[model samples]
Target: MSVCDPSALARSLLAWYDRAGRALPWRKKGNERPDPYHVWLSEVMLQQTTVAAVTPYFLRFIERWPTIAQLATAPTDDVMHAWAGLGYYARARNLHACAKMVAQWRGGQFPDDEEALRKLPGVGDYTAAAITAIAFGKRAVVVDGNVERVMARLFAVTEPLPAAKGRLKALAAHLTPDMRPGDYAQAVMDLGATICSPRNPACGICPWMNECQGRRQGIEAQLPAKLAKPERPTRHGIAYWTARKDGAVLIRRRPPQGLLGGMMEIPSTPWRDDTPWDMAELAAHQPVAAQWRPLPGLVRHTFTHFHLELRLVAGKASANATPLGLWVALDKLSDHALPSVMVKVVKHALAKAY
Candidate 1:
């Protein structure tokens, strides 16, 4: 098996990139200097999210907080509210921490070196490498999911993912040219995303079609195999929507760590996998001693690890305050940082309200 020349691959991909690269909100085109702040923010938002889904959020974030200094000074609740619906709430926390570190501790400058970037909150190997290469124009191998797929197809690597990541990184490093390393990284990613797609890759137009081992073997779509994920377990719980006659809803803040931590949510029973919490058990944990009426049906949501089924109980409370939690006006609910699950709970409760 003949190995594709690294220099040749870089040249081909860079040329193709010059002609056709993704016009993303975070990327710079045609020799323009990349902004480290935009790069960091977009990369964080892009994690486990698609480009289409991230673009509007990226624009909104930049519009709201244009600089690291601005983002650092923003209130945590405000940041969380802005970050609502993006999911993966911890990223929002880490993003704020990283910004504060850069703005206050580091004098409003992002570290250019990969090692230093890694020390920042939420930045790992891939993110650090991407920032170093793209934002700082450093010579670092950036192997994201798209790059991994491109490299796997280019080399026809058959080792399954998670295990094959090291080999893919090594292969990608070999092709990392010092000149325009950032563009090369984005180019390879664009190729995988647009051309060397997982399903029916458009090899006829791919720059490396001639040299791609997987393409040559007529198995471009089958390279870079992944291990099958196990079925996620289902958990059950109940949430109470105790609304005041004034149209305010009772809500509480989650503990500062773990799943959906530091976010606002309606009072709910403990989420458990053993058995569904009955109405009797759920009623005992209600925020107010109102005549809670169980809303028909269930609110279901899936997390990274498990699926949740929540039974919602809505009732009107005459009291202004609960023993625990606070009453937030229904109109002001959007101001709070509610996770998708909790948002779903609110929507379900409201939709069923008579």
Candidate 2:
């Protein structure tokens, strides 16, 4: 209910940001208009990823694509390859689809409206709003973890986060200036990332320190209460590692549309229901004893959806297996784009095989 003068706040914060904002690759430099493609791409990569982790990927993507039209015309495989090292393969797939849609269907123009951007593949509410405001200078309220945290502390919000997120967002919208909404958005984000950090916040350096309710109340750390995350349950699965005496490893392409999609991996038993793989199935598909060694360590990996505990059973065959997987020289592992989970399993098997 307390209306802050958003325009004055934005102008003051913009002055501070000129000296304090971190140099990020995606941002528009002095006097330059923001690039919609760069903003959109950075926003997509930043979801569920930290700024440090996304910087390299953003740079690489910009170098590779350079323009929205270039990215739009790229092959799906090439996009996937470009995003190989980056986790969250689904984002890359969605990026490719969105890029193509925008370039071909929209005639190489990005939608400035948040609602229209949301209609694009992989563009969510936050991303659409952020891109709209930052790239096109639209009056859209952008909310991310940084913004949420900053807002929560500014007003000394005590409502638990996630649960309190709706209220916080409403409050943030109230503080967004009609003019320079983009600068205000970036300023608040910079404040959260640096001065208002999650731990050991630098309140002394914050421009909003005089007005921060959390600091005034001596509860800056406690303002943003978040519910504890549920413990992640572990599950087990098996992977079939078949190597031919011709020195080739059996590799299969994962289905092109889901987790680990469009990548190579050792043949894995079905991952499902938090269940262990059947011993009988492994015996039937596993290679002969003399030529191959069944390496003993478990390949444990964590995914956003679930934790995977994988067993690797290795064996060598005289001839290449005729069914699903392709045989490639063991030394050529670098050529194929294997998910890190599969790579871990292979490395574990190889380390102890000899």
Candidate 3:
């Protein structure tokens, strides 16, 4: 193992990065400067999402709205529709809001400083630090899930996650060098993702293998311990699928506040932890007076906090007038910004239509 000095560690990691850094769409080669807009967009999409899953979406977004100004000028519904299947709908809303703030208020320029960047919607600590370091060529302690694992393994941190995050951040900050901080940040992230993986880490090829305290102790794989996650609570609801004779569907916009807010959805009963399946309880929340028939099976989805099971009820609306919500033509369903859950509800109801 080489000396356990911070400078030595930084030098070793950056040298390895020069040879083996992963090629990503958001990254720049050699001395080329990175675009802050791209960095912010990619970082926001990466939250709670994998890189493989986000790559196509990122490309699609860039192709459609090439600049922050373009994105800011786009309709909110358009952005929401583009963000369909990304799971977290709130990120899409915040991304649009942040882009508008940057374009309209800041004149299409992102603030280079971490503190100022954090004020933007969806720009958290890690994201702010990443944008400052990578896009603006500033020194910032950028820590994400990958960095946490690398730091925990390198320092042989024994405390479980959530509890050890503070200590790990401090250790990471200590190792952050002043020279080429952006490359160094990317290097560490690459090392963690490729070498210090969660299971069966490739310690032999790691640049910091000799310097890793966990490797010396033969506990690299088990260094960053995590507490057991509690069982997620299951919630139940019923979605009403009312279709007119002309093939128009009744859909409503969710209140712009909580989960799946501002997204289009079929009218439904409130999701509750103990919702009863009784006919009387389900009939009360029906959107219009119709002979509703319950579809077989349930539309199940998992959110960050809970599991949701939605029952689908299909019925024919007698009148062309939709008193509760808008009547969208079946062919134009894609025009609305419906979340994945609502899309599933619609598909299930259509498949079982009489």
Candidate 4:
């Protein structure tokens, strides 16, 4: 019940972690300290993404910038461009802003504690805890989805996550050791990722296999249940593939906020849930009586919040572009900050047009 007297379960888990932990690049050896910048960047990139998915991004980012100071001074366009396929563009924006703040305001050092770390843009509870523990060797309990699943299964927690999440966090806090806080955090994450997996867990090799409540109860695979998500709603829109007589294509920069913010894309009519107006209905929405021709297919994309069906329309324009976008040279399209979906749309258009 108290922090000093950790449960038998907690002791067992940490002991196993002491010997069986994996050696990751960002991790410090034995008594060495970890880099705050590396910890912070890795944590941010890992959000809503798997370790496998984030590894390459982490390598690419560090290769390009190498240090927090370099990242701080890098241009926003370059940062956004490097982060093109990373899905969450907002994180990229916040990472750029926070890097500059730390470099200029904090003397190129990440704050040593949770409060200062949390004050930075995009650093929330999980991020702050991770940075504090890993970067500064502070004793902070880091609870991410991996930790949540690990704790939930260990305690036979059946309340279904989001509801069970609070108690699971409390349990994890009790288990977190003061010594090797950074290693301990990574250990638990590794345990969850490799051993206590969501599907087909390798329980026999797990450190806590003997004490795990879910394993004891023979429900390791189903401990952390949750309400099923509603079927994602679908919407329809029209993407205009305007091209010059030459090979240039029309593209625009999205506004600096919502989904795919700050990325470039082919001009598109509004996306909506109600059936997209046919060619006639689209003309009503356009300000000018421009000529439009529908492409043979629809480009489908799924966002975290919604599913999108974009009707592709190809048209020709003079060097005089319509209000939304500029005519971009086809061969040099890679330079633009395009979302993966937009990239797909552009590639599809170019393949057919040229």
Candidate 5:
């Protein structure tokens, strides 16, 4: 492995961070410890999500609950509703579960070590390390995508990612100094987000420009190359949109497992990649049988793994129709915990004037 003085590197990083680090909402000023609740919530929300997207959600959550105890006591449905637009419904579920456990077991206090923190639901290694170092001032190595890129570039690592993650993590941990470790970690993140970006890195302005091996080798932007992923295949399904005579729509709660767990969604068949469901196949998967007709257009939403193409089948249900799902009024659909894809389905139905 390459060599550098850990202490000296951390000193430079902490120095730069003191003046230039982002003043995020969950962060605290000098000598003051941030509330562990804020740290845990923000860290969970920020995973595979952007800072801008998480900021408003964080603010709303803190304003609503303000404390771990309050969040624990809050209804899961309410929490899910607040997290409706935020993708990754599972994180919201796990966040609520973790809050309840922490409130009941530890008296609303997060553990100061990485191991204990990881025991909580939704808190993986990176999140545990972040809460430990950032919230509790403990020295733990925190490696996210930003830090991975920074380490790969600083050491001029030529290996592709996933395969290169172990070496990159070791390099990051080796440089993690005891003094102001949290600030040092954030500093690296800031450097990567702003200066050492994936494209057109401002090498001349980076604080570690001179120390960066990748820059010296004239491949700063390409140091951390990633393996190409396979193209996401498109899956087809049909959503049955049945509206009552009083303008109420049928919304069903997805089963408490798999994708969109515990969230409300329009009734749909299992998404399959093989072929579009025909009338005979679609009849077997209907939420409740009514005289059905095809809607005007398709409702499309891309998920993390595959692109979903949902054909809308509309029906008018009488008062005596089968009461299989909740009859939610169209205007009040926002009150329920509808995933973004379901919301798109609702909008498509309304635009069709059905």
Candidate 6:
């Protein structure tokens, strides 16, 4: 019954988890161990993305490539296409790389130990810890944002985040129980997500309500304070909607590195903090030379750290015109891996067509 005792705290949380844990696509039921492939895929998709956003993508990925070996053998472009709308395109690339590594060298079996798992592509401390505990049933500290918030409120830790991260992880490590460590880890995350929310928490029904010091102090909502983040800078670019006479659009694969890597994109000038694109620069980057007219509206999309403004221009390819990239038929665009931003460009261009 002692809240300060890690074993007792874990026991209380696990009991709640047994009744209230989320029925996610990857989560296994009672006495059924989690699949490491599902665990890895779901965790990767969940990064910088919400559960609502990731659910369909996870389902699609699993449906298409059910196993790690299948995913590794699948074409990287296909993976990127399937992962188009999911931001952080680099994760998709690393996912394919990791899958290939695991399939080829590890004999398609994910490593159970934290140290061994950490060596895999895109598997960092948090991911390695999560895989070790949730998939392998090993005792490992899992300190995701949800866990950090839960710890901060449970113990009334007052230091701001980033600086407070170390302390929070230490507390989470302490509470990480040897018994049912996997369930305990997920239970804490579920508690944070469903009950100890960042806004109005449902502490009345929280299993740890009586143990919560932040609630006693009347600041559980504000417990895990954070330093203010700097404003996201706005970047400007131009999206050229180059349509071939055959109703195909010119799209190119992004460079292997950098933002939106390995995804298909409408031909565009470099996205920069510089001014709205000058018409003269079109000669350098435009897919083909033709009469270019400005589209009616601009496409605005936000990345994690920046705001993007894209002006669209339309031009048709002549019979002799040979563009630099692949010309995908308009209706078949869905088959290609256009990032969300390029999807906007296509929509904007199509709006002008009708």
How well does each candidate superpose onto the true structure, as a TM-score?
0.96, 0.90, 0.95, 0.93, 0.96, 0.97
Candidates 4 and 6: which is better by lDDT? 6
The whole-model C-alpha lDDT of candidate 2 against the native structure comes to 0.81
Task: Write model 4 residue lDDT over 1-354, tens digit each, in one string.
Answer: 322456555566667777787776677678788788999998999889877778888889999999999999999988898888888999999999999999999888888899988899989999999988888888999999889999888788889868887899998997887876777788788888889988999999887776777888998898689878888888988888876778777778889899888878787878889587588776655422368878777788899878998888777775554556666788778888888899888877766655
Candidate 6 structure quality by residue, lDDT tens digits, 1-354? 655687888888999999889999999989799899999999889876889999999999999999999999999999998998989988999999999999999999999999999998888898999889999999999989999999999999999998999999998988888998788888888898899998999999999999899998998989799999999999999888888777888898889999888888998888889588888887787878877888877989998889999998888889788778998898999999988888888898899744
Clashing pairs in 2: none
What's the CA error at residue 190 for candidate 2, in Å? 1.7
Q: Order of candidates by lDDT, top first?
A: 6, 3, 5, 1, 4, 2
- Per-prediction RMSD in angstroms? 1.6, 2.7, 1.6, 2.4, 1.7, 1.3
Candidate 1 structure quality by residue, lDDT tens digits, 10-44: 88789898888878889876788778999999999
Q: What is the C-alpha lDDT of each candidate?
A: 0.87, 0.81, 0.89, 0.83, 0.88, 0.89
Best prediction by TM-score:
6
Residue pairs clashing in model 4 are: none
Candidate 1 Cα deviation (angstroms), residue 168: 1.0
Which lDDT tens digits does candidate 2 get at residues 182-276? 77788888888888899999999878788788898999987689998777777777777776766677888889877898887888667765677
By summed lDDT, the worst window of 10 consecutive residues in model 5 runs over 1-10
What is the model-wide C-alpha lDDT for candidate 6? 0.89
**Better structure of 3 and 4 per lDDT:** 3
Name the lDDT value of residue 290 in candidate 4: 62
Clashes of each: 0, 0, 0, 0, 0, 0
Colliding pairs, model 1: none
TM-score of 2: 0.90
